[model samples]
Target: MIEKINLNNILFLDIETVPEEENFLSLDDDMKQLWEQKTQYQRCDEFTPEDFYDRAGIWAEFGKIVCISVGYFVNKGDIRNFRVTSFFGEEKKILKDFSNLLENHFNQAQHVLCGHNAKEFDIPFIARRMIINQIAIPNKLNLFGKKPWEIPHLDTLELWKFGDYKHFTSLKLLTKILGIPSPKGDIDGSQVAHVYYVEKDIDRIVIYCEKDVIAVAQIFLRLRREELLIEDEIIHV
Candidate 1:
């Protein structure tokens, strides 16, 4: 079934996120308490809420998307080019711009959004952030009342899982095992908050996010037993 879907119909993407504030103290008392409560089970006795604040980006309620990099395949004659672009800056602006892209260009019923673990993270995070920012959710990301097969979203992680719900594979690991180029550079997901808040290098984060998007597209191709994308085929727009 994966082979039946047209590569041109998919919008591949990845996002970089950071905590709403630079530090735990930056959050108001109410939010600080909420963060503590929310992470209690995961942090347990190993780390305080303040220490765990660095990972706040993993949750939409505690973090804001710093960048969303998207790519799509465009076939011009025999040449295949994957055009990549990003939306960064204010959280609201990022969400609004992405919403516009979805509503305007990729709004067709046959269009789908593809990412690594997108259904669990990228898709929902965007929806929640849009609601918080008071932007209307685009139909592509809006999952309300849609049957499982009717939703237009593809997840490389989910595809790799097959039927093992207990299994989890990181994109870096997946790429390595599948012979796709590693996406990691000077920073990784763990350091995104530091880069955004302390180093203030959004460009670096954008590059990292774009690499993941490319990797996701490559992974999907590999799963479908098709050729992987060459670096020369990637265009940063």
Candidate 2:
């Protein structure tokens, strides 16, 4: 059996993504034709090398991080003190700085990295962007060769399965089920891109990302507490 891990080593993180640029909407003839055929939201109108630069611009304008919020909870014998940090600005620098901080300050003592849907989204996204910028990924996050189950990851969404993959659960729904107040506020995921693109408000994106991190953390805590009571009534009666 795998040994139980100390939660302190785990860093829970989430990121907010937006289209690279406004001008990316002006695509080449073939791409424009493809975009024109798709429905409004379904269109990939903002994808291009130029759009990547636009994303870089937003990253610079916001502080280099496109809104990455990480929550670290270390158990201090009796209680856990959760420290949350929001990273914004240039993707490369912010990622490098955070990687260094994690290695020098956090990685040495931790047992594992944890997040909600992190394996599918957050981790790879950060790793790929780091590669794009030629920044080395922290050793703690270098999981390219690791086996899925063998990897030291604790995804609350995966834990919800409890080894039985029957139903799909979202963070919001899980939080609601556990009686944990949803931190989403008035902004949903669909609105995130628009808020970043139209409003150009980095603060809003930061707040939104922080809320998601908190929600994921809460879900983890609730699961640990065995507070995830299945609503059998909703399914059986």
Instruction: Tell me each candidate's RMSD, in Å, in order.
Output: 0.9, 8.4
Clashing residue pairs in candidate 1 are none
Segments in model 2 whose C-alpha atoms lie over 4 Å from true places: 1-3, 26-65, 164-167, 226-237
Question: What value of lDDT does candidate 1 attain over all alpha carbons?
Answer: 0.93
lDDT of 2 by residue, 1-237 (tens): 112555566777788765444445555666445434432343256554443333332232211237788876655675446667887866666688778767786666345667777766677777777776788888777887977765656777778877766756888888888898777876876566667668877788787888777778777767667332222211110
Q: Tell me the whole-model lDDT of each prediction, alpha carbons only.
A: 0.93, 0.64
Task: Spell out the clash pairs found in candidate 2.
Answer: 9-110, 63-89, 63-90, 64-89, 64-90, 65-88, 65-89, 65-90
User: For this target, which candidate reaches the highest lDDT against the unseen true structure?
Assistant: 1
Write candidate 1's Cα lDDT for 2-48 as tens digits: 99998888999999989998999999999999999999999999999
Q: Pick by TM-score: which candidate is best? A: 1
